[model samples]
Target: MVLHAVPPTVPRLLTDRSTSEPDREALVVDGVGALTFGSWQRRATGLAERLRQRRVAPGDRVGLRFGAAEWLDFAVAYVAVQRLGAVAVPVSGDAAPAEVAHALADCAATGLVHGGGAPGWTGGWTHATADGDDDTGDGADLSTSDGLAQILYTSGTTARPKGVAATHANVTYGAGARHRPFRHSRHLLHAFSIGTNAAQVMLMTALLAHPAVVTLPQFTPLRFARAITRWSAGTVFVVPAMAMELLAVADGHDLSSVRLLGSAAAPLPGPVAARLAAAFPNATIVNYYTSTEAAPAQTAMTYDPERPDSVGRPIAGGGLRVTDEDGRPCAPGEIGAVWMRSPAPPRTYVGDTTTSGATFQDGWVRMGDVGYVDDDGFLFLVERDGDLVKTGAHRVSTLQVEAAIHEHPEVADAAVVGLPHEVLGVELAAVIVVSGGAALTPPALRAFLAGRLAPHEIPSLVHVVDKLPRNRGGKVDKRSLRRSLT
Candidate 1:
């Protein structure tokens, strides 16, 4: 197989990398072995040609359905779709038929490529299938900078998921861009699903910098910990929940090779952050704050002793503001809605003008999160705008309550939500996961938090659960929690 440099699009990044270093390891899986740069380019391009042979043309939406550990199929289809100039929509392989149907209808996808999700595919779109293979040849380079490259669906909690349309430039920011090389970079380990922004960042990093991208196709506490030791992965990215899980079992595994640990997709609880810092003492531990819609509009920080809760300031080229309900700026330390402007050029929702009108205004996207910046210019998220609870005459933040609960040594994990009340408009309710061999009572737990939180923020009712339900993206599925209670 021969390789050559192409354009700056993602497909070209792979093809170009293959040319520059054909024998270098590109994608690594435990049981599936590895794919060299040359082999990956050859296989991905041949699949792109097959996609073109079908009526799957440029500007079409292609749904890619695959399970968690099937990165090889997922990565190939991603390159294949983009190489053919079609917008790829990655659907969770575990989605129910109703859920899959909704996504298929929402994007009006032209093709459904069932790589490894369900037994066979069912969709109105034409179908393309992928197992795995390698045949050398190049496909047509039809991608443009401004063309719609992907339509990533958000994990819908309250309503149907909305599609976020990303342009080629929006997704391929660092591909072939100039950056100083790292001193001792090794493989990058991440267990992120293919659809998330963090996963895309890892993909770009793999193409641009990392010699190989190591992943846990399936994420369990032990498996995640052992992968680090097995691969000697230098960098790892995880959501706060995954980070928590790793904290629980990481002691058994050797993680000395890690030099950079990144957390995002949710707030890293202060206690959890401290534990992770100690666990990876030599690593530069950082947490990022970003949204699906207002992506690349992120703030990051290397963990600080004094400002542990702050999610850092606006990164270079990014914009941020905490504004009152009337659109005026909030004073430092005053809580307000967070609005962000991405470093990438403006983006709007696909086929949802009502939401587009409400969110995308003057190039700024309303983040729908409530937060405040501290005196030292560090941003702190209080809660989601809709997640705030109104109890009697006062409002409360669930995150504040949950943070306090996590401070208790007996509490492993906790989630707070507003429950319907007869007297008060809404009452605070706590769902907790206690540590192993530890027992917690409602009265004792309430007393534990009484000193840490305001009286109004304390839970009126407590329920002990073995685990909190998590969505595909690892966020607490409050909607499911509500359903389970009712």
Candidate 2:
């Protein structure tokens, strides 16, 4: 394998890394298996040949579905599809049959490569196992950097999932051929699902970073803590929900080896970030903000006491701007639409041309989020555009209220949303999961929040549940919550 100064496409990323670091451990999926860079390349090459033999061709869509435990196999299948110049469509192994069918039909997938724990739905597409033997050799010409590489579906918390298509250039951008992505650690651990954008980034990291990527088949606070201790992992990543769970169990684990703790996929509440800082002690807590469509462009903020609420500025060459309803850029501190610009070509929704036009323009991708940029250019997310609570004449940020609610001692988890009301356009409502199942009444909770929040910011109605409803992406499912409340 020949190495380029910078791998221009995803296939070259794998082939070059394998030749350069043949003996290095590339991936370690706990409970499944581990693979060296050389072995990974061989398996991927074999799988690509198999896929070609099955008539998988350039630009053809192929679904690669595997369970969390089978991440190694999933990784191989993903690379193989790219090597054959086919578009890889990855869905979680635990996805519903309906979702699998919908994706296959939507892409008119040519084949499905599955492993243990994959859903049974095939939608009449030819299928094969993700298990590839060690056959070492390259196949037909791989896709160019500008060719469509993959189509990732958004986590549909509010509606049906839409396919977001990306080219090889979009996937390989900023990934260097010679330099390691992370310098502080030799191992990076995360529990992001296989079908998520975060997972794709991690996959790229495994290919380019000096660190060996580590993960569990599934995530539990106890399991996560144990992995850190076992591997002496220096870098760790989690979403806000996972961070909260780790905080609850931090007393039971030895997490002193961690140098960096990153939280992504959602905003890291200030209270949670403060607690995490104390819990990790030596680790620097960082929050990452990005969407599937807007990545590999993102904003990263190292935890700062002064700017606890800001999500930092666009990294390096990326750009972030908040715009008003008409797409005019908003002045600093004015909350409005948030757009992130990537140095690489932008990704767009597949098939939905109207939505694609609205979301992606020029090199900027609209983030579908409501936020403001500080005078210093740090971005502060207020709420999802649709989730902002408008009651009477005021606009209330659900995130602000939720952050305050999280400050309460007895609140374990909570979600705030605007419910329909005859008098007001919408009334603020809250559903909370109390810690230790403590009896928390609506009035008592209101009194607790009175000092911390404005009168209108307080929830007009409150309900206690065992756990807040969440989508597969671990985000609060506001649509389902509203339906249940109404």
lDDT of 1 by residue, 286-399 (tens): 989887788768888888878777788888478889999899999998999998886675666779978898788887988878999988778988888878788999988888
Q: Output the TM-score of candidate 1.
A: 0.95
Candidate 2: C-alpha RMSD to true structure equals 1.8
lDDT of each: 0.79, 0.86
Give the Cα error of residue 353 in candidate 1, in Å.
0.7
Candidate 1 Cα RMSD (Å): 2.6
Give per-model TM-scores. 0.95, 0.96
